[model samples]
Target: MNDYKATVAVIGLGGIGGVAAASLCHGGCHEVVACGRRPLDRLRLERPEGEVEVPIRTLTDPQDASPVDWVLLVTKAQDTASAAPWLERLCGPATRVAVMQNGIDHAARVKPFIGEAIVVPTIVYYNGERIAPDHVRIRHIGDNDMLAPDTEDGRAFAALFENVPISVGLSADFTTLAWRKLMINVVVNPITALTRLRQGVLQHTDIRNLTRQILDEAVAVARADGADLKDDEAERMAQFIGGFPEDAGSSMYFDTLAGRPLESRALTGALVEIGSRHGIPTPVNTSLLALTNAVSDANG
Candidate 1:
């Protein structure tokens, strides 16, 4: 069984990271520390029913941090390299690092930074939007806020959020689930970012057609990579996109609007890279990645 009063350290304070810190603080069960470049006194989370406010114990320097039971690496996929300093100081043999970022192969991504610490890869379903440095809004996207592989560490990760609003589900077929989420991500994020529009943009006829090609190519790559995706996964993805709130925007969308570098390399780029290895043609994603990378480079 996992300890209820575990010491949890949260690295990165973006939208996703901010919600995580606030939720853990709201639980009041764990000793939670927020690690980032800047110090935050408190966090206010806008929930569906009400607002949750929690004081944050933030560490602005890696030298001030100690080993913790859990570390939620909530930085963007491109920012993982920058979090290495904190990982070095906060990780011990017994530490479990939960990676809550885009893309797959989470273990492999963090292996170089963490020596022997266990990696808990997760599929985040909650839509967390940072309104300000210390304020965020959480929109429950689906039944579960996150999904992890059904294992000891996964269960312990779930237990950590037991009293929080975020719900973590476990599944034996995590690979398939990750691919399923990837399909939706590749479509919504890129299309929205490129157009500077919201989820409502998915309703356009042109966007629908473009997303179809993107999903078709991504699913092919997923199948080649050993994911047990269904024949109609693209159609299912379209259905899900049709249900998204029109006013809602994706992380990439907001990033583009804010002139921040896009995470295209992680979302669209990952699929294209795998497609090359499998000898599968991902023309659609390649084109999208190229365009998005151009935008990301302009911002960088």
Candidate 2:
């Protein structure tokens, strides 16, 4: 297993980070370094297939870290600032950094600390949760897919996950890709968080109509922002979400329940911000953004 040569630092070992660390370790092709605020000797990932234990060099302090071949910034968008110290130490001139968080314009978000490193924007499609320290529960049985821009660095980033179960591929149009994922997040996250319900709420006729309006608003904003989204994208997403598992919940819902700060700013807030900049109205998303922020403030 030690034969795999590349060194990877997975920052913020939460659900997404845990899944990435586990899959990469399962690939058996790279040395993984788990970075977080707490110390952990190992990471336990519980998938439907079976349980996987990945032993990693966990570091609590940025001082103990050094430059790696790849740095996976898996923190929430709102916490980008907090991960600055880790990025400062883990990135070098040639290091390829992947921003594995939600929202668009990922490269610009981390550009401040990454300096000359190649920044790859990654969009992850999977469901997982960190149930305890060093332990995570894979919420879905489907394959975890990661989509990156079709470029030299993007392909190289995808190569790091070779032999892993997750699907790592490149997209010719990353703008549409990011907007597509954002459409899903904006639709389901706020509703689930506000109603304290899971994705099952979308099954209701009234809720489905509301979801459509939200998606429509977000799609409009995305189009104005230069994404090539289709007219029927909202309709298609509403149908898909309606058929989702009754107990399926979004990260926002989980964060609200856990009393953790919400990433509303990254999800809906981003939509609203860009919509304003482009002179496009995002009334539905703006309202959701306010409600989600209120929930976060309450929790705080």
Candidate 3:
């Protein structure tokens, strides 16, 4: 039933990219290419209902890849450079690159690699865990698994998932929504990674107060960046953070435990950068950024 309607190349087959590739293949609406550091013959997708095993075509070498209609750049912000080879091969003038990672500067991170291609900044709310290199688990975290700007390409990106279980939404004010998402990341990633704990740490009263401080400063930065956030945005975000599952571990926590460089530079670190640009004082995030950097440097 697959007519190869479109060519979709997914680079960085971690939790997010892996599950996305499997979903697209299961949907059978496009010709999906799973590009990674090594060749893989099959992918196991664990869902709430059951597990699915999909036979997939994976390209471990960049030279074998060609321009595709869509490139889902799912690499961590810090590893964007490592994925340059794959982006160069899979991106063309007609390509639309959907960056499905943390941080706000999605286009700036991936633009240089994709020549004349459109950069689609995306917000992913789904929780995905890479249990193994070939095995991945996905849990939808919100009403929508993904969100894109309400543009023609964003609509098309959403349509690509209409036939699949994962839901994609289009937003007119994607920037504001993106900042909202970043507001969450700035709290969870740093707290979890620094404490070497999971989301449970955020439940502590002291930690909750700390979360407020971080958000107050970060929210100021977000509003300065024109995100339409209110003065009480920090309070709103704290309530939202309280809703996360305690057992859930953040991406940075996992990276810290694995002795890999944390994505702090993108999450908390990005907040600091934006805050500085706006001449706003992000003392809380700035300190966290330094701690996270030390942790990341020790890992590297």
- Tell me the lDDT of candidate 1: 0.91
The 10 consecutive residues of candidate 2 with the worst lDDT sum are 137-146
Candidates' C-alpha lDDT? 0.91, 0.86, 0.90
User: Candidate 1 residues 1-300, lDDT tens each?
Assistant: 345699999999878999999999998999999999998999999998799788999999999999999999999998898999999999999999999998976888898998889999999999888898999999897899999999999999999998887999999989889988888889989999999999999999888889889988988999999899889988888878788889988888988998999889988998999899999999989999999999999998
Error at 78, model 3, angstroms: 0.9
* Candidate 2 clashes between residue pairs 3 or more apart in a chain or in different chains: none
Candidate number that wins on TM-score, 2 or 3: 3
Q: How accurate is candidate 3 locally (lDDT)?
A: 0.90
State in Å the error of residue 206, model 1. 2.5
For lDDT, candidate 1 versus 3, the one ahead is 1
Candidate 3 per-residue lDDT over residues 91-208, each given as its tens digit: 8899999999988989888888888999988999898888899999999878999999999989878877878899998999998999999989989999999899999999999999
Best by lDDT: 1
Clash tally for model 1: 0
TM-score for each candidate, following the candidate numbering: 0.96, 0.94, 0.97
